[model samples]
Target: MDSLDLEVLTRARAWLDDGHRVMLATVVRTWGSSPRPPGALLALRDDGRAVGSVSGGCIEDDLIYRLQRDGMPESPQHVSYGVGAEDARRFGLPCGGTMELVLEPLRDAAPLDALLARLAAGELVERRLDIASGRSTLAAAHPEQGTAFDGETLTSVFGPRYRLLLIGAGQLSASLARIAQGLDFAVTICDPREEYREEWNIPGTTLTREMPDDVVTAMRPDARMAVVALTHDPKLDDLALMEALRSPAFYVAALGSRRNNAARRERLREFDLNAEQVAALRGPAGLYIGSRTPGEIAVSIAAELVAVKNGVAAERVLKVATAKAALDIAADTLSACATR
Candidate 1:
């Protein structure tokens, strides 16, 4: 679930508490090229105000216009948009796109409060709503579960969808954390060095002064998690890599030059990790973007991480080491010709 949806729920609860009628809308399904995915949320108040999005903007406008003219529904109702070409154009949906939404009139905010509390406690929750009665229930959810609708009930997964453990507290890490958060990743920065730990002031990130290896072990990285080592200190980066590579983390990477990464791999092999685990380490992390500055490098690394998370084919991505080596060979050829 997106953090923005949480904001919608928060605002909805607040509006209800303030004696205003609130209508919560959830996109239950989408057919083709939709701007927002299923489980996206929008909250509408009685006074034709909204807090989220369904389509681009026209859909929200229509909803607001309906609310002012028709008032809130007595129970949950299913509303759809873009069933025909004319409707698609009118609602600003892409050609042939269709989306179904469930709009529930808010009579109580207890469920929203409960859901938000679970999310704050870092627990994955599934909110189930009955379309007929406008009643809902919350339950513990597994990480693999996603939003599902069976025509009568809507089950939406909400909580942190992805986690990122960054083993550094430097400028590059700061930039990466901001990007990751924007990508809906819960970020944690770990650095034992007092000098580096003291300087980390990035908001919306958990800073830890514990050893990187210990932090990695505690995180027990799963498939939805990524572990990145950016401190460039072998004692720190190598230790974290040894543990992260052994876990199911979808992306385990370290920041370094190609030569440094090669050496780091050799050092990792000396640990308890097997050959395959050592091979899993992505050194010189990021795509071949020719990035030089800290911010550019962070973007490159974030791009690669997203690619890996999305299951992009390896052959489709150009690694930094591969591209840099090719560039080096081309430079050497040019130098030899000049000398000739």
Candidate 2:
């Protein structure tokens, strides 16, 4: 879930506690292009007040208008928009776009409280809502499952925030952590080097004085996790990469030049990592953007990480070195043409 949906839950729970009736709206399906994805949340109060978003703006406005005029429905209901071009224009949906939403009136606090507590505890919970019976239940969400809606029931998975484990406590690590936090990742910086660890101070990320490899072992990185080696020291980055590359981390990368990363892979093969496992390492990490500053480097890396996390094809990604070289040649040709 994104931060928007989490904010919706927080706001909805507050309204429920204040004796205000709240309606929870979830985007369960979308056709063509959508401003938000499935599982996007919106919490609407009995009054016109609201939090979160289902569409860009117009959809929320229409929802608020409906609630204000027609009042909250007694049971869960289904609402859709953009069936026609006129409706699409009115709701600000993109041309040919459509959305299906599940609106559930909330009066009970027990389930909400339980769901919030479970999420806070870092547990993945599946929220099941039966449309006909207007009943809801929570269960442990499986690792590979995602939000699903059939004709009868809606299953929304709420889990702990995705995590990014950085095997360094330096300027690049700090920059990357800051950016990753914005993307709603629970970030951790691990460094056994006392000097580096002592000098580090980032607000949201956890700075641990543990061995990088040990930290990776403890994390038990799953598919939702990312492990990045940034320290550049073999003693620190190598073992961590060895563990991470073998694990199920969605993105496992190291900060190094092309030559160094290649050498690192060869070294990892000596440590019993197979050719395929070492091949999984994304070194010279981040897109090729000719980044010189730490912050720029972080942005380039974070962009690539986001692409991989979204399952973008590697072939389509723009590598910095190649891209920069190509652009430089183009600029030179343009300069020659202008001179002539």
Candidate 3:
């Protein structure tokens, strides 16, 4: 999935180089309740096919209509919408605030290619737009200063997806790792036990047997990173969880039954972690799935992780109860009925 996105941009760059018209759109500003936040991207093709999005379906719809209906500007340009109350009503902006967009036709992929290379190297890149001339320049984004959007320059952070280090290689780990991968998280599975470690394999994921704590120190999980203890072993799970909790990793969780989870929390308190540090741990780690198998348990955990990453309520994520789980539930119902 990560490669697919990169490929799309690469194709866009190709189109630009071939002298086919193309335009880049960025959501520079948003009002209350905008569909997408600032820094969202939408690329336009001369033929009107687009990659990525910067607004609700409505905005994309309008942009496509305009592109196909009328060719892009002869030269690169920046467009603004929803600034005035009247424009907001017409565009259906959330709260009638203004948003600016940089719509540049790429004549050279050099700029974008260079920026992408820097970003891939984990170097923060800040894209600066010169409003009057409509030229864009990319530079390193400062750690202290996040990307910003002004009418003149719209700065965006690229190649900064959050990461997840799942401790323990098991069915649950595989499931959770796949989910994390789909969510654009760089995931690694760490298990010291050889038995489980041997079976550890998932596409687009790294499997390692390094001490979970050591891995934690190395990843340097930022606010964007999360550490999940899928292994039930305290020796393995505890140290990993401890290291992660001590750092800036925003989310840390452990998998266990509710009873076990409570006990685990208690143990953390004995480790000199203040109530807050211990409090950060979410045990019984998944949303209740009433799961009985490893696969279902993994799905449950993965769904909860995505919810945390997206800041969406767990209840809000759509869950499809598996046929097996549904059948099991039905069978239980019939058994109870027969007993009655």
Output the lDDT of residue 31, model 2: 92
Q: How accurate is candidate 3 locally (lDDT)?
A: 0.74
| Candidate that scores best on lDDT | 1
Model 2 regions more than 4 Å off: 94-97, 198-207, 324-340
Question: Which regions of candidate 1 deviate over 4 angstroms?
Answer: 336-340
What overall lDDT, based on C-alpha atoms, would model 2 receive against the true structure?
0.88
- Clash counts for the predictions, in order: 0, 1, 0
Each model's TM-score?
Answer: 0.92, 0.86, 0.77
Residues 1-340 of candidate 2 have per-residue lDDT tens digits of 7766778898899999999999999999999888888988999999889999888888899899999999998999998999889988888777777899999999988889999998776677899999998889999987577779996999998864589999988899989998987787888899988889898988857788888899999989999899999988999999999999889999999998777888998899999888899889888888987799999999999999999989899789996645756898999999999999
Report the C-alpha lDDT of model 3 over 51-83, residue by residue, as the tens digit.
Answer: 877676667777888788877866556677787
RMSD of each: 2.0, 3.4, 5.2
TM-score for candidate 1, residues paired by index: 0.92
Residue 95 lDDT, candidate 2, scale 0-100: 70
lDDT-better candidate, 2 vs 3: 2
The lDDT values for all models are 0.90, 0.88, 0.74
Clashes of 1: 0
